[model samples]
Target: MKDSIGEKQVKVVIMKKFLIFIFTVFGLFVGWIAFMVYSYERSYNEWKSSYTGKIVTNSEKQFSSSSSSTQNYDYKKYSSSSDGNKDDLESLMNMFMKRLFPPTLLDPDYTYAYEKAKSWSKKHLSQQQIIIYLTKYDRYSEDATQYALNKLNVDWKEQALLRAKSYQEFHYSKNKLVEQLINIDKFTQEEADYAIEHVHFDWKENAVKEAESSSNGGNISKERLLKILVEYRKFTQEEAEYAIEHAKIDWLN
Candidate 1:
């Protein structure tokens, strides 16, 4: 009986020691976690304070105190090495600064819209075209898209001219090209007229090329080709007649 009693006491003592060890280890782990969190927060706070203070000091220096008038400072100081226009560089800097430091901030939506619009502008798309694409296709908010559009310094006339020139390979008529620029590309009527005036192409030759392409199947009648050119391809009746005369096709076959 004495031996059994001593064995029970030994088991109890072993369990107590195990429990104490587990509790001690758990306490230490919790203390380590707390220390890590405290360290990260302290580091972040210090960096943020220092960086923000530096930015403010620089910003104050950038704005002259005497006249209190905003002068166009050389944007090169804030600009990255990338080759972009002055406005684009300024927008980029704005986004970068906003991302790095949080203050009176621009919406993320606006920033994204601005970048998207900038990309479309590089593709020679008109502002109206981009706005339509943003609102209709991308489902961006109109306010955000319009805000982005307002910031851009795009030459709509030049964009229209570039877009018009791109269709030269397709052989479009002047009237048809104007319709395309206005209806399809969303360029203003004035811009479309400017493009048509600037873009050089022979409408009659385009009609001929289009008629020739249509007759490549060798099964289409001349009347069909003429109709297709005039009605479907937007070529004038005279131009279509000229195409039917010039294009080589076996009308009987």
Candidate 2:
């Protein structure tokens, strides 16, 4: 049978148990600090070795071969040098910088962080930014961010379509737009064609807009306006002729 505890003794027992728990927590904290210090020292040595051109082979870990299967973590950071777009270097750095450091307190889950980066890229960033944004945030951990980055369902064709619509705001002709989509934005020929077909803008209005907006040195002539619309704006011969006819400009001496 258990002994019946008196009130005074019960209070004492409770105090002792509380003290034991506090001690356990304190001990764990001390151990964690020790581990952190050791890790720092190890990292310092590795940095020194790298600086001295020593291979960090032992520390190098391979996640997998195909990027489809895993996060394709570059222990060195950033995507492969083989990436086609040389122009993406700027946005890539921006995304990498976000992932450089995580919030100190109230850190969200790895998947949340990864998805946040991906969403940002989808709305307003490049593929380079989306690719490595989360992996670096997790310090290259094999977590949900890594998995999501590796296996995301990105629609490049849709991205092309959105960019085309945005460009139409600036009133670029279909020819110039196709060139931008294919060369600068890095869309395939088929994707560029899709964007051109889907983008809605009045080509005649665009030509007139360009003609009226031209700030020429002398009083602008109708023939010069026609040339401007055709050569610079990439308007078709017929479109240029129509714009010149409709644009009621004071072509004075």
Candidate 3:
């Protein structure tokens, strides 16, 4: 009877060990399945985000293409009126062109638009008109119109230059044309001098204050500021000298 009782106890112990091992295996299998499910969910979310970005990019491209197509059509319609009065036609053309070639289209990638404007100028505009249009359009082709302005012996050249300078003065840096003049390697020293002499720098105190607060102020060098002033046509020889003197004393340190 003692031997039988001992054997029964041994069997009970074996059964309990087997049950614990089965439960442990089951828990591990469940954990592995949960990990796989989480990984799949993460992968799916990433793919969705990528697809969404692609869709947005495509939509923006489509919108730009559509806008360009519409503008081309409008140009044709407005330009086709042969019986239209010259002043009326010019006014209409100017308004339409402004809409067609906004400032955003001035990037190098939009060389096609620049070519189109150049072609239009040659076909339909007088020299003065071409200068006006190109300057207004921000399609200033130095190789093309600037050369023509030099050759034309027209009083309008000064007018065109002044207009271009004025536009650049207002639109380019925050009155940093003097700095730009110094930095640009493209212009000859004589040309830079001419531009500096003619550049309009009706300096406003507010503008100077704004520049002081700008991100460019702390890092901007005296030479660069002088160049910008020259480019902007704002600095007289005396003012330029004074600025140099002041910058050396106040800013260089």
Superposed on all Cα atoms, model 2 deviates from the true structure by an RMSD in Å of 15.9
Question: What are the lDDT figures for the candidates, one per model?
Answer: 0.79, 0.64, 0.51
Write model 3 residue lDDT over 1-253, tens digit each, in one string: 9999999999999999999999999999999778666655655565557657866986687567656578786776468546444544454444444344443343342454355455644342335455555566756664445544444444432433343364453434322453444343233334445555676644443234333433154566666656655455354445554555444223433
Candidate 1 Cα deviation (angstroms), residue 74: 60
Candidate 1 local lDDT, 155-190, one digit each (tens)? 899999999999999888788899899888889999
Clashes (N, CA, C under 3 Å) per candidate: 0, 0, 13
Distance (Å) between predicted and true CA of 145, model 2? 9.6
Best-performing candidate as measured by TM-score:
1
User: What shift in Å separates residue 2 of candidate 1 from its native position after superposition?
Assistant: 99
Please tell me which model should have the higher lDDT, number 1 or number 2: 1
Which parts of model 2 are misplaced by more than 4 Å? 1-113, 124-151, 215-218
**Rank by TM-score, descending?**
1, 2, 3
lDDT winner:
1
Query: What are the models' TM-scores?
Result: 0.54, 0.46, 0.26
